[model samples]
Target: MASFSGFIRKSPDARLAVFLNAKGVHAPDDFNWQSEGRGTKLVNDINGLIAELPEGTQDRVKAELDHLASLATPQTMTAAEQVCTAQRIDLEGLQGIQDVLLMLAIDHPKTLERVAAQASLMQRTGGKNWSAFQFEDDGEPWALGDDIARAGFVTDAIALLNLPEHRKREADWYTSIRVHPITGEETEVLQATIYVEARAESELTFGPSEGLERQVFQRVLEVGIACNAKERIVEICANGGKKIRDQYASSFAKHFAPQSAPPVEAPRRDVLLNALLSNPSFPTEPADGIAKVQVSSLEFYSVGGGFARFEHLGDDETIYQFLERQFGAQSPIHSTGWTITGATLRIMQTPEDGTGLSVSDDNQCRFLTISGDRFNAAQHGRCC
Candidate 1:
């Protein structure tokens, strides 16, 4: 039986300990082969195991044990640097081989050494490119000799690709930047592609032409930013050039067409007049920043909707126009055809738009309301 304490300084020694442990040695702590008289037993055990193995396996195990003994020298702590002295291995490459060596120390020392040598070679030569590998004209992809050879090639290629310089070369050209207006957050967009296709036969005049035609189209993506208010998309580019258009019978037939419908227009005043006379209430104050006039009954309607707010300017003019000019004729303060009955007040054509006024019983003209087909008195209140 043997014990390992200081003797188990590195992976090779650890591998030896595992081997010894599996053999029912009962290896104890503070194990020193020479001082504790266990050295003879250990040697005898190793010899017995080797004698049982095949000749080739015996030789390999013996050689590896010898190598491990040599590696136990004091300076072996830095043995990796000594072994890879002139070889150029990137940190990643060095770490990869080191991991393999540690993992296989017990049974595959020779393989570990071979892999390390190959890794160093790749580090020096910057790895072999797959495209540069020669292939047989018989249609085979590549001739990498055997599975082990292919693995080595792939390992080297991975090391090279992990380098920052290699990655930059493979990165796409255009970088997209997107920012959220509300949060002021930015995001990077790696790639965006727009595919365009056309038909070959569509361009032919007489008989059946060729098959389908596809073309590569490239264009710039423009982004704009504005402040103080929200931004809106004004337009999008659709043309993929003339050759593409001709092949697709004057347009890209595969692309979806955007459908746009016209805005719904407000109902005409004449139609709304009857509804107003019956209900006699405004739906809502005109959209904020605009004023509207409404007449509940025929008497108010006869006065032409209580004279639109900015009437002195023209029949077609509105308060918005008056404010823009900043020099318009004063608006007349004539009766807005409003009449109060109990708590409810009725007025001519409801102002379709305005910074709505609040109404209460105590406030003068505060109970003001409007009646018109367009206005629903029940729905309208102080602007939300």
Candidate 2:
């Protein structure tokens, strides 16, 4: 196969990727169905693209492409691995049934076929802590979750980054690609993750600090940015960027980069409070681009007086709900990125009424730390 370059050339915003990727190729809305004998649009179009590609290049990509296509099959574990290697499995001590199946597949298709085939006749074992299969052959322990505490954390990490919106993996693999907008340079991006699993407050606690809950999710996302941000930061500093190298970096983000430690932000807080209260946008979500959407939770501590106030709006509720449905549950149904499920509510100190939820009325309460659930785990923890 010969190499050829392709370009999307149009989209600057990553949000417009789908349209950009599919642009320039005109297939009949039904053309792929007619041409490829496939009823699916995505399938037919992909096949059409490969068909048009130079021959050798298609062969090179054929295996990789085929593997990706199988994830949609929604196959079950037991049937896919014909050999009932073990009835009980420990995912913690062991990786997972899927991991074992992966190593077996290279040598044992019979094992794979049997396991993949028997999707319906399956049973589960183990407590909420773990599960075992009733289809025990040879009493093997090819199970998973013996290390739910650790594996679950890693699994959660993979879920947050490699997959978007929680999609299943393909053939024991998760695939993703990043493309440079200007150069059309398609490159593989390796995903990184920071761990977050449901743990007791003691286990979850890190740093002798505040906002233990939000830190859980923040670490997960920082891993994503660290993949690219670290070198970028170093590059800027090495370039003799005076503002970051000498000014903000020393006082701001660098101080709090570590989860186990944080510097006192009293000085920064004083400076920040002036700008934030004046603009009230420094602490805005996105904290950068885009207009504020909806304020779900707000907690404020007045420096002049010791007090705390809390207010919550449901995910879809607007700030003006005082005029309407004010009594409905105000907490968030789900968190934004960390995927920690919880009812998000704002904590604020405001003029108290007998009917509202209780919060400190003293103004001296001063902002201890602004916090909320990143993963919405609060609701789960509460119900549990």
Candidate 3:
């Protein structure tokens, strides 16, 4: 083990890392694959690098390196522990499973240590919100707490996960490293989170199996001058720099130097409108075989916009026939009128004819009412 130094800086666009050490090596592609034996190798490699450092500095990093290696085993609370934690009775009075889980998770010794490490780094680097590169656990953002604390929000999230209909929920741990590209100096922090249904009860039956996601950040000293045109914001860098070396380079500079306003232009309303309407790409159409089918259910992964849109068909009719009738054989499906309000979808068959289906949304469509002669193929159904 060796002493690691410097502020951690993440690349704006890549998960790949570049160390500023003697070898300047990049971590193995599988550096984060904890269970697949890849993470073990990565840990070994780091240990080897640490060993090469002078004896005096080794004492500084041995423990931390060992801890990183320990994470090769995915972190999660056992069912008994989770249940117990959720049902715990404390000074707050009777707590719901969600309340217990949230408090326990936030106060998790490992999680608290990680959060503290991040806060220390932010303070050391003079990094502030939006200015510092954020580390994401999987796709979820992780951040330090504020003066009022982040407990309320974390509780709300756990409550959502513990909804009556949910079968299981899990929390997994990950880590991110920030290093000085020129010095191999570094700071690493653990980040833990659970993706929607990531470790459901069914998933845990097979033992620890969630995947680990990781990233390392390294800072490079580069200066950038920005020039903005109507369509492009070009960056000219020092030492003949032609492009932006890193997205956060400007922020890094602002931290150490007086900030200057770079040239900026607001687009005109006409330009903005044109950009929105021109060459718009509509969402992909449902698969050809997706029609006249009953929907069993929908699973939402995130609260924003919620559930992913997927249409599944029951075994009633061949998808071809449904599509052929819905869209005229010789022409594309042209919507004469469509209105989506609340949970109902009202669509007109054609401008000249009142023929279409009125679909209601639920866990599944409760009813799909057909109108006019458009879908007259089936006696009870309406199709042409």
Judging by TM-score against the true structure, name the best candidate: 1
Q: Highest lDDT among the candidates is held by which one?
A: 1
TM-scores of the candidates in the order shown: 0.19, 0.18, 0.16
> What does candidate 2's lDDT look like per residue over 62-100, in tens digits?
543333223213334323322243312222332334344
lDDT of 1 at 306: 38
lDDT of 3 by residue, 295-340 (tens): 2212112223232221224345433344445555431122222211
The lDDT of each candidate is 0.30, 0.29, 0.29
For the record, the alpha-carbon RMSD of candidate 3 to the native fold, in angstroms, is 24.1
**Candidate 1: residue 345 lDDT (0-100):** 33
Q: Rank the candidates by TM-score, best first.
A: 1, 2, 3
Candidate 2 Cα misplacement greater than 4 A, ranges: 1-62, 68-356, 359-384
Rate residue 135 of model 2 by lDDT.
18
**Lowest-lDDT window of 10 residues in candidate 3?**
4-13
